[model samples]
Target: MDIFKELQERGLIYQHTNEEALRKRLDSGPMTLYCGFDPTADSLHIGSLLPILVLKRFQLAGHIPIALVGGGTGLIGDPSGKAAERILNPQEVVEQWASKIKDQLGHFLDFETKESPAIIANNYDWLGSLQVIEFLRDIGKNFPLGAMLAKDAVEARMSKGISYTEFSYMILQSYDYLKLNEVYGCEMQVGGSDQWGNITAGIDLIRRTSGDQVKEMYGLTMPLVTKSDGVKFGKTESGTVWLNAEKTSPYKFYQFWMNTDDQDVIRFLKYFTFLSLDEIAVLAEGVEKEPEKRKAQRTLAVEVTKLVHGQEALERAEKISSALFGGGLTNLTSAELEEGFSDVPSATIESPEIGLVDLLIKGEVVTSKRLAREAIENGAIYINDIRYTDVETSVSQLERLDGKYLVIRRGKKNYYLIKFK
Candidate 1:
């Protein structure tokens, strides 16, 4: 199947300008396709995954992918999907975050080789240099104010008073397409479904500016991913699930996928993974036969985690997940154990010299040494999975896992993390 057909089947193609013609153009040669990442935050969330995956698909199909960092447009803020005016970060902060984002993209896209080596560009390179008069006359003239005002993002915020700067975002984005077309012959742009208006605007800009002197530019967009229950995708109880491991650890990232609802699993498999139709069909069968096993969910989580976090990180995340949820902690790596125990409630002591009863009292695992002794005597307190019967046993008797982390269980289901300095 052709690229467009495959995207449609995978639910990746939301809307494209002249889908047939664009597919024809893509088939003709190794075209340079582009996707813009607006550095709205320090790290990308799950919402941004669609475009990155699309770029990967284009690369796999022998097309060159140009990843655009929206250092300029991010300053102005695109109003495409916002309910209110975004608080613009100071330019310096945005620049810093943009650089960090560029670094983080390495985990997903390869930029080393010349043959389809992923190319990166910052829109600030061109946008920051343009003069106001030049912009108004040359670029602004093509966009009619009426058409701009009719957009959903603008119209929704119009009642709340959209700012002039926010209103002009489409124009700036259109200019990005024009510049890319002129400089690198970048003919295609990919974005989320909310960006349909902006993508078409860019396509029109390329047509108007180049005056049919070059090949027609293309726009491909993926649908905004939404959960079946109406909550937004990529969000957790805490907030956004970030791509940066520091912001959202690899284990949590994997759990985000592992917890996918049965209904959404198949669709997620298609949109996120490069797994072919036949392979997905097999997974679908497994989902039918044994929903309790959650085999498809595991496969989806594994594939996505590997893609985003690499094999080593994926393995660590899996180990952490199994150890925590499966209630078995002995096989966990030191890093995995640390990650699993990081958020649990715990207290620390300088040394293992204290007696078990006094340590439990001091560590606040029990209110008093008497209570701590009773719990241990009744087989309630576990030190490294062993029930300590002797209250006089020193804290040194506790077996430290990996020579650092100590898992303290208070009765069942109440766990505490302890680390020795």
Candidate 2:
């Protein structure tokens, strides 16, 4: 598919300057484009994935992408799209987060290649070195205060008030474009729809600050991804679904995608996966025909989970899901069994020795010792997957998996873990 068509198909392009001209330029040769991500958090949420994915798309289509970690701009928070002035984070915190964010992004881009390789840039490199006089005399002159104030982001805050720090956000962002253009001949910037103003500011900066001839620059923004029900995409009641496994576990991440609304599965597949249009069309058709089967949702979940994490994590999550929901647990490794059972309600036995009746009572699996004994007499309990008919049988840590965890199934779907620690 053509560049513009493919991007539009994937719901990537939101706004751009001169699409026809940009398309022509793109066809002629590789062009360098960049998107900046601030280090406001240690892990980038799904909100940030749109731009990162789009950048990867550009690279796959034979272009160089520069991912700018907002180490510098992060210190001076961007006021665009914010309701109120954001709490400024310490410079050291921002720096540390910036490093972490860059490392996460590294997994998605190809940096080892010499041809159209992706580059990581820190705006701090230039922003840190600028003297106040030089910044005011050079970059500050081009950005008129009136124009900056006229922006919606700024005007909306006029009632409350805008800080000098925030008011200068536009200038700083615009200078990023100018810097990219001057240093790397970067001709385009891409970001979410919220960044339109800052992107325009950047284009304006490049045009005014560059050589005698007005240089052409472009901006592209993706639409804000909001669910049909208006729930913010990629967030759960638990919190933001982070790309970092440590922040959001692989099982939780997989579950997030698996639970996507049937209506949103197709859109998410397009937005999140590298699958071709034809392939996604097939999945779309399946989603339409047999949504009850959740064919598309499962594929979307598996592909995205594997992409973000890895194949091994995807397999592990699948295994855990199967063991938890499919009533299948024989194949689970001892370690897998522990990870899967970690969150289940647990009752620990101080001395890993107890009668079946006492074990059931202690585990709260049964209401009382009488009921526990009756359950054992009725062959309702199992130890190590073996049916228990002996009311006097004793349970011990010897039956636990890896000598630590005991998988207890109270009923068909009520599973619990017993720890012997």
Candidate 3:
């Protein structure tokens, strides 16, 4: 299938300008396409996945992918979907964020390919050197004030109020496209639905600047991902799911997808995974025939986790997940325990030997010694997946998995971690 058709099948093509011409251009030969990511945070979140994956798809199809880091634009945040002005980050902070984001983007694209190697560019290199008079005379003159105000980004923020710094973001992004086109011969730009205004503005800038020289420039965007339950996708009660493992652990990231709603699983499979359409069709059937199996959700979780965090991390995450479900914890390593119980109720004790009731009470796993004793007698307390019915039974260092950690279960679901210092 053509690259465009493949993207269409995956439900990735939200909006594009001049589809027929773009298709013809892509069909003719390799075209350089760029997607800009502003470093608003130290790590990119799940919200940024679609654009990154889109760039990957294009690269796999023999097109040059340019991952543009918005070092300059990061200083002046884009107000595309914001209700209020963004707190500007220091120049040093933005540069640091840009460097980290550039490294993360490297994982998604094949930079070492001899043919059509991926390119990483920073807008700060050029934008920083630009003078106010030069910007006004060259780039600013091309964008009409009426059209700028009419854009959804500006219109939405008009009532709430937007600063000149943010309002000028579109022009900066447009200039980025012009610069990329001039330097790399980039013919296309892609982003999420929220960036439709900015993407189109770039296309307009390219046309106006190059006139007859640049006959066709393309813009494409992906849909704003949202859940069937009406909540935003890529978000949990805790916060956004970050690509950085330190920010959001591999286990939690895997669990996020593993818990995908049945209603949204098949769609997410198509959107997120590189699995063939036929393979996804089989999973879709599994979703309808046996929702209890959760095969689709599991596959989605495994594939996405591996893509973001590597194969070893996925294996560890899977093992940790299984261990949490009473699958057994005899083989769990200390590092796995640390990751698995990172967010669970935890306490530290100097000595490894302690009575079950005392440990429970001290760790705040149970409110009182009396309650801990009652829980033990009632067969509701377990130590390392083994039932502990004796309140006076003492946990020893020998019982600790990996000789350092203990996993205590208060009931069927509530678990606590005890660390032996």
Candidate 4:
């Protein structure tokens, strides 16, 4: 398979140093390639998912991939896409975050595969030890002041007064490429479009330093994932959609994709999923014919959620999601209950046994016990989505989900969670 062509067809390739050279190199044989991710956050978001998947695509196509975690540069902070300087974190905190990033990257790439085992390189291993004098004498000398100032990343920040620390980021990233090339024989670097400047800097550094040994080092970048509205992807009203289920529950993760706009879902499938172009073409037809059924959106959600969170978590998410609308809440675990109804109105009680009218009042389902009784008499009150018509009965008579909670549906849409502490 022509991995280069596949990436291009999927619209994953934003820019490349030399398409002809890169394609010819990819066709000749497997070459080592690397992509860097800084430990800017504790968990990787949907934005990082694209390049990580692209790296896996290369690995599946029999190329060596190096997942470079920027423990070194992370401390310095890359200013390529930022509007202002970043507040530096302590060295220990950055190391801890880098360790977490390494774990997340492991889920997608196959390090155990014998043919071309993926390598995880920490720039800290080399960058952490280099003396400032040695860095200036060796790496710094190769980067021309004019060239550094001309990079779009640096140029844009120059008028706003770019700091020396951020201005030096390009050279630091360039040294990473030079080091990886010498150590791993890595010939290519891939990143988001924002890193175009840093990526090219690295390629040039490799050429200048390696001299005759320079064997066609290349750089490629994927488009910065964006919404149809042109806002950046991976954020919601709640915050970043994190890969860690603890940070963003699996149910929420599933919903994030399930909620992809009609205009964005098809393109997202191509960018995020391993589904073949032919299969995606069929989905596109479905989208054109029946946007109401949302088949394409569901497929994209299922494919991506399963890829990231596995079948079991995917099943849990689907179960809770369906139950919320279809009245199957009994099958869910306590943790699932919390995740499913996290945004719903909740009231806590000291005991599970409570008068139905009083419970409804306590749960804030109704303004008063009289209103609660009225709702019950009218058969508008539901316990765990089952209509409860008896105003005299107590909540203890109705089954408590997981022995501790009652899901009260006041009417067709409003839901209130009553928790027994």
Candidate 5:
């Protein structure tokens, strides 16, 4: 099947320009396509995953893929989706973020392959060198004020009073496309639905600047992902789901997918995983026939975790999950415990041994020794997954996991980590 049809089937295509020409271009032969990622943060979040996957999809289809890092344009943030002007980062900080994002982009694409290896380009390479006069005379002449004002990005921000710096962002992005087309023979640009205006602007800029020399250029955008309940995707009460392991541990990342709402799991599998349509359809049948088993959610979590964090990390995440839910913590490693309990309540104590009641009070797992004793009597207190019904029970180094920590559970879900210093 053609890439376009495949994307349509997977619900990736939101909007596109010149569909016939793009279809003909893809059918004729392999072509180069580019997607830009602005370095607004050091790590890309779940929101950025779709575009990166699109670039990978093109590369896997025997087409050249160019991943552009917006080191230059990030200085003047794109006002596509924001209601307020962005607080610009210092040049050094922007450079650091750009470098990190470039490295992260590499994980998704194969750069060493002999055929159509992925290319990474930074817009700063050429953008930082353009003179003010040259920019105004050569690039700025193509964008008229009325047309710029009419763009959805600018129009949305007009009521909020956008600054000229942000108003000029589309031109810079358009210039990026022109440069990529000239240098890398990139004929298509793909992004989220919010970037439809900017993507089309680039196509127009290339046509106007290069005149008859420029071949047909295309713009494609994927739908902005949202939850079935109408809330935004890729967010929890804590914050965004980051790609960096440090920012969001592989354990939490795996759980995020594992807890996917039954209404959204099948849709997300198509968008995020490279599984075949028939395979996904089978999972969909399981979702209906055996919703209680959560087969689809588990598969989604495993596939996505393995893709982002690799097999080793996925195994560790699974081990952590199983140990926590199935009472199998006897063999957890220190690193696994750290990742698993990274967000759990924790306390540090100098002594390696303490009475059960004292430990509960000191670790703030209970309000007072009286309450702790009551909980123990009621069989609600557990240490290292072992029920301790005696209030006088001592928790010593013998009960510590990895010889340095104790896992305390109050009732079924509340977990506390006690560190022995």
Candidate 6:
């Protein structure tokens, strides 16, 4: 099977310009393909994973890839997936976010590959300086009003309201295709399924502007990632699962995949991992026969976490996971402790010599001194997973985890953290 066929089998191709033509084109030689990433946020989330992986897949298949960071269009906002018009970000702020996003895209594609080193292009180079009159004459004239209004992205919001700034997004995105094609010989555009309208708009722009000078260009999108339960993928109770470690720690990132529903694990493996079809088929069988083993989920979590966070981070994440659920935080470093218990409630202690009951009261482990004493005597209070019954025992005597953090367990599952300065 060809590369496009491989994408189809893996369920990555949602829409393509033309299957036979794109396949013949792929088989012909190494062609340049591009995917746009708008820097609406400092870091890309798991929502952007499918297309980034697709770009890597094509690069592995011997095609040149262009990871376009939308420094320009990001300022304008693509109305494709928004329910309402977006608040325009300041230029400097958007530029900062664009640079960060460019760095994040580097984690996926190898820019140093000798065969066809990936290219990172920002649309701002051209869009930022284009005068209004020149833009209207050169780029905006190609887009007919009726066609622009007809797009599902625009039409969906017609009843509620749409802004002129957002309505012109498709044209600006179309110009991105024209600009890339004119400069880098990019023949294909890829994005999410929501971008069908935008991608096709770009394609049409190329067809009109190039006037048979450019060869046939194509567009493809990936399906929107979703869970069987109907909740969106890449989300937890905490918030979005970001690609940045500081935003979403490797431990939480690993846990997100580890908690994948049994029904979704195999599909996610196909979409996210570079594992061979035969290997994935075997894992699928394991999912069928040994649902309780959670073998598939574990593999998915490990593979994805390793891909996104690298080896050392993945190891730390696993160590954190083991320490967390295994009822011990004693072995964790200060950094690991901070990452694992980032969401847990925490209090600070000025001195390490505070009384145990007073520490409990200060940490809010119990409502009051009486409650703290009752819990301590009842053997329900645990300090660093060790039963601490002596209310008079100084906290300084207990060995602190990483010489600073105290793990307080009120009951079996309720956990709190105390930090010594």
In what order do the candidates fall by TM-score, top score first? 5, 3, 6, 4, 1, 2
Off by over 4 Å in 3: 212-214
Give the C-alpha miss distance for residue 96 in model 5, angstroms: 1.1
Model 4 whole-model lDDT (C-alpha atoms): 0.89
Across 352-373, the per-residue lDDT of candidate 3 in tens digits comes to 5678788998788889888988
Sort all candidates by lDDT, best to worst: 3, 5, 6, 4, 2, 1
Q: Please, what are the lDDT tens digits per residue for candidate 2 over residues 34-128?
A: 99999998889878888899999899888999999999999999888888898999998999999999999999999998889998999999998
CA displacement after TM-score superposition, residue 95 of candidate 1 (Å)? 1.9
As a whole number from 0 to 100, the lDDT of residue 134 in candidate 3 is 86
lDDT preference between candidates 4 and 5, better one: 5
TM-score of 5: 0.97
Give the Å error, residue 248, model 6: 1.4
Clashes of each: 0, 0, 0, 0, 0, 0
- Please provide TM-scores, in order, for all candidate models, with all chains considered together: 0.89, 0.87, 0.96, 0.92, 0.97, 0.94
Q: What residue pairs are clashing in model 2?
A: none
lDDT (Cα, 0-100) at 180 in candidate 3: 95
Task: Give candidate 2's TM-score.
Answer: 0.87
Off by over 4 Å in 6: 212-214, 352-354, 369-379, 388-397
lDDT of 2 at 265: 83
State, as a TM-score between 0 and 1, how close model 4 is to the true structure: 0.92
lDDT of candidate 4 over 33-119, digit per residue (tens): 999989998888888999999999999999999999999999998888788888999999999999999999999999998898999
User: Roughly what TM-score does model 6 have, to 2 decimal places?
Assistant: 0.94
- lDDT score, candidate 4, position 151: 90
Clashing pairs in 4: none
lDDT of 1 by residue, 1-421 (tens): 3777788888888778886788788788788888899899898888888889888888877788888999999899988888888898999988988998888776677788677788889999999898999889988999988888887778888988889999999899988888887888888888888888888888877777766475577787888998998888998876889898888888989989999988899999999998898999998988888899998899999999998888999999988887776666777767787676655677767888889888777667889767887988998887676678888888787778888767778788677777787
Per-residue lDDT tens digits for candidate 6, residues 1-421, read: 3788899899998888888898889999998999999999999999998889999999998999999999999999988878988999999999999999999999999999799889999999999989999889988889988998899999998998988988888998999898999899999999899999999999988888877575699999999898999888888889999999999999999999999998899899999998988999999999899889888888998999999999999999999998988866888999999998898889999998779989998998887999998999899988887898887888889888998889999889888999988
